[model samples]
Target: MMIGSSNKRLMSDINVTPFVDVMLVLLIIFMVTAPMMVQGVNVSLPETTAQPLPSEKEHLIVTIDQKGQVHISNYPVAMESLRHKLSKILEGRSDREVYLRADKKIPYGNVVKVMAEIKAAGVEKLGMVTVPIDETPADR
Candidate 1:
């Protein structure tokens, strides 16, 4: 028997177990964080049966919390200056549309007041964001 001709064969197969484990870990991390990535002021939206609007472009969002505090995107804006802030923000944008999300617990008058201010800001279109009514029998 030749000394250099042993029966051991070189292992050519790639070990994919570690790669699969890493991928699974990344998948789990994304799954856990996906919902939280949609960051916004937390508010309980009222349910509506209206059809969802089709959005062609990103629109500025105005939010009102349960305490009736107004916010542009995530930043708080005073009611006294809401119109001014909106005017300046919309001056350069052609869409001039703003979506309002107000807590259902807030009084309707507060929502109307916010809407009035939004209109005063020269916004051409104002959309109300609402949760769709659940049609599932289990929910009823």
Candidate 2:
């Protein structure tokens, strides 16, 4: 065998097969976990025909479940302390806006009580969150 004529050759091309495999795995993982990532208190919202309001930034959301438990985001808050908690949360915020989500089965009086507490906290604007009315053919 000649000294300079070796069978082994230098490989300058990159092996992209492993990279593509890793990327596909990551994509599948995200797809599988995406729907499970939705975070909120479960409540059957009242249906409405009103247009949805545009959201520019993250705002405070107060939710009341069917069992009448109050929540700020995902944390539970007692009705008695709602005003104090809201005030403390909005102490430095300029907008002082809040959104309320209540179960449709909840009594109107309970909803009014929560609204009163929100107003007492000095909130400037209060928005109600409702589900859009379904326009499916079967419903009609």
Question: Which candidate's TM-score is highest?
Answer: 2
TM-score of 1: 0.68
Q: Where does candidate 2 stray beyond 4 Å?
A: 1-38, 135-140
lDDT of 1 by residue, 6-95 (tens): 778899999999999999999999999999877779788888899888868788999999889999988999999999999999999978
Which residue pairs in model 2 clash with each other? none
- Lowest summed lDDT across 10 adjacent residues in model 2 is found at 131-140
Task: List TM-scores for all candidates, in order.
Answer: 0.68, 0.69
lDDT of 2 by residue, 8-78 (tens): 88989999999999999999999999987766788888889998888789989999999999999878999
After superposition on all CA atoms, what RMSD does each candidate show versus the true structure? 5.8, 4.9
